[model samples]
Target: MTSRNPWSRPVGRRSVLVGTALGATALLAGSQLRFAGRSRAEGADPWAGWQPPVQSFPNTFIEQNVPIPMDDGVTIRADVWYPADESGAKVPGRYPVVVTTHCYGKALLGAMADYSRYGYVVVVADSRGTGASEGSFGLLDDREGADAYAIVEWAGTQPFSTGKVGVDGFSYLGATAAKTAATRPPHLAAANFGGAPTDPYRTFITQGGNWSSSSALWFALELLGVAPLPFTLNSYGGLDVQPRNPTTDIATFLTRLQTDGSSIPYRFAELQRLIDGSNNFDNGFWQERTTDVGNIDVPTLVYSGWADLFLRDTPRDFRALPLERGSKLMAIGPWTHYSLPKHIGSRNDQPIDDLLISWFDRWLKGIDNGVDRLDPVLLWENGSERWAGHDDWPVAGTSYDRLHLTGTRSGTSNSLNDGTLTALPAATAGSDTEVIDPLAGVCSRQTVQYLGGLPVYLPIAFFMPEFPISEFPGIDQIAPCFRTDDRANEQGALTWTTAPTGTDLLFTGPVALTLHGSTTAADPVWVARLSDVAPDGTARPIGEGALVASRRALDPARTKYSPDGDVVEPFHIHTHEAVLPVPRDAVETYNVEIWPTSWRVTAGHRLRLTIDGAEFPHLLPNASTPDRLGTLTVHYGPDRQSFLNLPVHQGAFP
Candidate 1:
């Protein structure tokens, strides 16, 4: 199932390749083990500060442009950060290695360096082709995963290393880390990463077979060794660059720029072919790209947030890991991609950095630090702002509750028709209509999420009205008013609202939306959003889902069903054989899988379901017919009622 060329050797012809060839065993053959301790540490922890968590080494040193050779003689390069003495010289002794791969040309993802001072060797590599490494850039390709496996093993077996390795990164790098972990490399001790989706096809490139323009564009530009200016915003504090890692210096950068000009066009062509062909399906090329964390055979710490773009997969990834593989942990906090480490309320009590440090220390250092005894799932409840520990994801006490749509008005938002959402079906059949809008979801938090949190701190909040600005150097730029507030984004949508609940209702997991409706066009796009409407009628989006009607065929085996046999999570078979045609006049059943969320709708707050035609820059319809944009008709009644399925719980998650 692993794709390998077994013959493409670009290292021989690469004009800009840096670093020298060294075998795994010979990498540190001449190096000798050296031990040095702090003047104040005969029996005490010297680097300890007023900080709650004590430190290890006083400083760190970088060994730039270290070569990570693959079996076929191709060379991958990395920058190694070694624990240092007070004077800042590499303390050469056996330590565990943590390898993180990046597609950025330079030291873009530098947060990995911070772990070096914690007594572990941290190695950051530029993934093949994107940086100075030699090969055609394979974005999330199996070959790249192959490269990650090589990097880990190479860093592991070195003389200065203890032959134990862990992988780290977020988003793109996180995907590569997951792949590396899946390979089950012998030296792979653990994996600590975040913001990764199991299937890149679902959120990164396409959603329910709907094309996501912004993320796709961002990655395309990155393959060319360039990035959108917006992506350069705060990176969870990953800005510490270590001098000139061959690929980062002025001379090598100019040369790689030239290489990108000649190579990226072909890369773009390759990506387009996949989009135009069978890769659009869930099982072919996408199957290879999907991260099967189940294949992982070691301890892992998968970090995520309810507000992340890939929220649906974070908990899913945790649930998939085999219990036979010792201990693993998943932390779901109130975070966006840029607000990655910004723990909110109960989460702050258990700092994210502290959790990561304790995890790696326990696994890599062979320390019995008792982190394994921590709850398998650490979650932050939104409205209540309380931390809850659970035995597993989806929580033990969760029960799927269905709420049907009706034509009666709730008088909530000023959407096309403020239809009613209820626990029971309507007595009589009715339909509400709304004209299709091609440009939607731009003025919402989704804009920031899909952009990888691009404008999180940018001062242009007024220009976009979607990004939060409160994080930007203590600037009160009206960002607090827009973070999840979705009134502007849903103005053109057709909505169904639930009357005020008698008590609090907690939605703690994946969500599904069923639409028994029809569109005026031959092919249509369905965008569904679940929002919490306060007593003041202010609606804030909680979760969202989208589907291209043509790819709506479901795979029964993989779909999740409730105890009552209702579909809780619809798994669609997106192959060409499964594609269905949309007739303008006939009503069809369409199910949209909303990304997971953890939020509470209070007693006075109502729940609103909004249906639109597009998510704009975030997603575009992938229709065969060019003129598929049309009006939508949502039907509600005992026979043809559409409804929203929620993962509801009454009290503590248990």
Candidate 2:
């Protein structure tokens, strides 16, 4: 049931934060003024990269398998880490608490060793229905948010708590933290999120309004980890059944699994089924799961990468946070979802430990760390490979530049057509068409991102290379590689390229594309990409998007627009009733949302827009049989012109 978008789970299922002090120690010892490459206007140094010496505890101790009762009477599992004296004995002083909940199980988290190793008490809890927690797995259900609220309040009442609590994590765990923050728990003083997006229906579950089973395989993996069958017991160490009742007991664990694993939602199994069929539409169920950032009252920090899967909304959510100015912070790097803040694209030197430590110290401990005076946003200009401070996302002085598709050539890219992309509308009428290759995009960076950079780190290419299809020539090049050129994957793609520019084009926000075209097939699947083609013809990916022709009904209220009333980010209704059928061979206009992104294309680089009728691994185009595999045509002319809107920061160039 999963989309063939490479091989792996969604979000940062692998990157987890544990209670560790060693990491915190590194932060404390790290040089604060190290990011000399950070972009700043003359005399503009708002970022308090200056890390003050954080007072630390001699040691830390964990209370394993702590039973935490939720509001619904079901008890969840947690591991409470407390600051200890030099002798490794627990201390008596009360400290601010950091609470985090995860469906990936508490025991699997790595030693995030930065917070607890300091003076704060950290409580890591397991989401209900996963790990040792009682209740069926809610996969972004409201029940999980309620459970977080209960856990936060409980942590605030502990003997070592200062009555101030902060929620934190990366990916799914971060989403839980955001959900907890939205509940506005009495003890939640601040929150931090990394690659954890609040809007799921349009961005995660059904990307670009094209239904996605992206989580099906991941959910099944979770199901297999904690299933009742003795042979299906977790071998990944992501779950611990004995921890629910005892500290250790293999036989008892198997016995408990056999008796208690028959849940109403069947934990992972039932959740996946619901997502695949009944819960596919955006309705009351998804609305409850989507976190409204406006409801989050505490100070928050948003962290994400340009290539991150959830980049679509993390910045938008930050811009929506109720807190004003520097009360909330955001950092958008040039890395992927697979990378952590500490280990990023290396454009920005500050690690998550450093950022979070200072953040926690400022709000949780009342330190005058100058965090509230720092620029609200910190971005790493991708092409420049440098950090740039900003007032906010969409980068303030950004302008929407429209690039129209034309029949002429730019002679820049080695694309299938090498067609031209200019600012002015085309004078002549022309249309470009290509046969629908449903299995395209197997060798691009999107494949690496979907698989969480697996091929880059492991030998996935050696074992699971791209399958060769007789119908699609050169399909055998699907072998995964790290950050390779896109020209190979651009085969059969209809491209629109611009002449090399005289000045840098700094794009800092969501891109919108208006398409006036039709497909011979009734249900057309469209995939588009924006790339920066270097002088040597290396097409590096900037961002990518996809959509099924039938799901194009827009929701005006949720759709974002510019001052001139142009759609910058279009939100579709995606509900059961909003679905409209496309007539075969009939022309139709559609808004193709190019997912939000931030990057700088050098002066000599040419911008290219590549379109394909099919995408593999990231999206399964044939989600429905008889959906038509006919030719996809893009029309261009004065009346039937299609254009791509880019957010350009005019002030970025010298």
List the RMSD of every prediction in angstroms. Answer: 14.6, 11.9
Q: Model-by-model lDDT, in order?
A: 0.68, 0.68
Position 376, candidate 2: lDDT = 82
- Model 1 agreement with the true structure over 352-395: per-residue lDDT tens digits: 66667777888888776656766677676677666666656666
In candidate 2, how many Å is residue 162 off?
0.5
Q: Give a tens-digit lDDT track for model 2, residues 432-458.
A: 888887778876767756544444434
Count of steric clashes across candidates, in order: 0, 7
Error of 1 at 271 (Å): 5.5
Clash list (residue pairs), candidate 2: 4-617, 5-617, 5-618, 6-617, 20-113, 21-113, 24-114
lDDT of 2 at 297: 92
Lowest summed lDDT across 10 adjacent residues in model 2 is found at 1-10
